[model samples]
Target: MVIKKVSIIGLGALGILFGHQLAKKMPRADLRIIADQNRIQRYQQNGVFCNGECCDFNYVTPEEPCEPADLLIMAVKFNGLKDAIQSVQKHVGENTIILSLLNGITSEEIIGEIYGMDKILYSVAQGMDAVKVGNQLTYDHMGMICFGESETGLISERVNVVTEFFEQMEVPYKVDSDMLTRLWGKFMLNVGVNQTVAVFESNYGEVQQEGPARSKMISAMKEVISLSEKAGVQLTEEDLDYWLGVLGTLSPDGKPSMAQDVEAKRISEVELFSGTVVKLGKRFGVPTPINQELYHRIKLIENRYTMIG
Candidate 1:
């Protein structure tokens, strides 16, 4: 499709990271930040800062009259996906390729149910330490985005076009042949690192250390490995070790999105991570006690913001 016009639905860490990178390459009018009126106003006023540099993006609302984007990126949290889907309705054309940078594994399926599977490209953002606080996002490493066709292994036209676009934008990416395994690997990493850090109110440094926190993190990830086996998309200790290595490269103080959510007193994506694990564990007859506990602990953290003393 050549990807001339691009629209992004979220301004989270990953969103800003890619948006900022694309903005540097593409014309300002070619890349659109799709948001409602309220969010547009807020973004215009507060401005988006990536690594202390302000981003000047073309902001468009759902109701605005414009041509559909060639590429649409959905980076909203799980809780906000519904609204994001609706907000980007005016921006989706027949040939538009959609990529979901959400943490969990179900976002593609959820998006595809409405947008058709043909338009959806499975994607995962890995090895990034970007953390967003307020309107500012800072990252030590710009992670590579892994994406491919829905079924994986075949580089389709859409995949090639997206790859070209990413190349032009100088954004790091990997065209994965086995996208499902990569997605599950990322899910396992989130199930371990995100939930564990959020629960303990610690940073990457704590889990990187050899201690109870690290042990608990590995235990939680082990549950995902078990469930993956039952689901026919198995991840091994090697994958776990690989992710641990990625975690090691991240800045010690960098907190994941879930940990940032807890610190900001915002709702986290526990339902997508450990919640998904626990649900699937039941279906697969895999005991996911670690994820179950992590799920409860994260929920408890969320409840603390609203629960009466």
Candidate 2:
């Protein structure tokens, strides 16, 4: 089936990047930005800027009845996933393909539990260094999305449809044979880079250099690699090295989403990264000292806000 109508939730960094690309490539009427009434009004007034160019987007409120989208992109934060799922309900048709761009390993499952798993695809968004400050987004690399069926070596019909849509949109994507491993690799990257950066208030440049930040980042990821073995994914040091190469390609001045969240004084996705690793470490009888420390440090950072307020 050809994917024509596309609906996307969450207008953050990645959302703006993809949305802008889609708007440029496809007819404006075919893309829908789903949000509540207040957000729609606020976005219309303030406008969303991608690299200083104001995007002309079609915004639809969740309550407004419309044709079900052929593809639904969930770009909301882990904390906001539940509300986002509810918000996009009206846009989901029986044939709608769902892709959750949220970080960590469990988002697909979380989304699949509500919508049927049949509608969900395992996807990992990697190699992007996009940063959003307020409504403005800046990035040098737009990144590529890797998505496929849960089973390896099976190119399903839905995967091909999404692949064709991405090609038309001029967005880079890869159809992986083993999507689960790719997702876990992404989870490992976030568990390390996002947490360490958030705790130290650093950017990609800091972590890219050989120092405490980079050391702590790799160490935190090592803990996940250990847990992956027991959890059955069994990520190797090679996977970790692959992410390091990707990190080197990012804009040194750019930051991860968690670091951006901390700088903006907003709630970050510590829970999704370190929090998830810590939980899985315990479940799999693995030790996660690096992640435990990172988790504690980030929580302290969050606490300072409450203490000051």
Candidate 3:
């Protein structure tokens, strides 16, 4: 599959980070940054800066007439996904491969349902510590993205094209055979780190400290592992320990995306993390007490923001 045209559907931190990298290698004409009018104006005025470089990619919105893209990347938050899907309809052709970097287990499912299942691919981004302040994106840790087919787990032609795309753009990525397992692994990480940081209103260093917050983080992660096993994903104790090791390696001052959203007074992705866990727990007959508690606590904080509005 020859991937000529590529479109990214969000201009958030991860979107800008990857878009900037892609713009460095790919022709400006081949890439399109999909955003709304306000964001388009912001980008038009300020541009997307990452690591001190400016992105020069074309920007478009749903109101504009555009051709379908060969590859479409969805980088929006979970709560924004439904509207994001509708916004990208004109950019998805029959052969367009949709890859989502959202932090959740069900994003691909939602995309597959709207766009045909065969067109959607499973993917997740990890190790990124990029922070967005206004239109500026700064980060020292550029993450690697993992993606592949959900069912066959085979290296298809499209998968090879995606890998080649990342390589050509000098972006780090991995093609996994068991993409579902990888997605669930990332889901567990988000459930533990993202929710804990948001609920405590702390950073990674604080979560690593010895306290009730750390205990709650571990308990929530363990519950996710149990639920994954019941769902037949085979996530084990070792995987949980591996994630803990990964967390330890992160920058002490680094804050998860949820924590950043909370600080900005914007809605976070709690629904994708603890909310999803609680929903799946009931389906699998597994008790997710830790996740339920975290979900309610985060909701209370979010409610205060809503009340102020």
Kindly indicate the candidate among 1 and 2 with the higher lDDT.
1
TM-score of each: 0.97, 0.98, 0.95
> Which stretches in model 1 have alpha-carbon errors above 4 Å?
none
Tens-place lDDT per residue, model 2, 1-309, is 998899999999878989999999888998999988899999999999998999999999889899999999999888999999898899988999999999989889988999899999998888889999999998999899899999888899999999998988899999998988889999999998898888888799999999999999999999988988998888999999998898899998889999998887788888889898889888878888889998898889888886786
Error of 2 at 170 (Å): 0.4
Alpha-carbon deviation at 135 in model 3, angstroms: 1.6
Q: Candidate 1's error at 233, in angstroms?
A: 0.6
- In model 3, which residue pairs have backbone atoms overlapping below 3 Å? none
**Model 1 lDDT vs. the true structure?**
0.91
Q: Against the true structure, candidate 3 has what lDDT?
A: 0.87
Q: lDDT winner among the candidates?
A: 1
RMSD value for candidate 1 = 1.2
lDDT for each candidate structure: 0.91, 0.90, 0.87
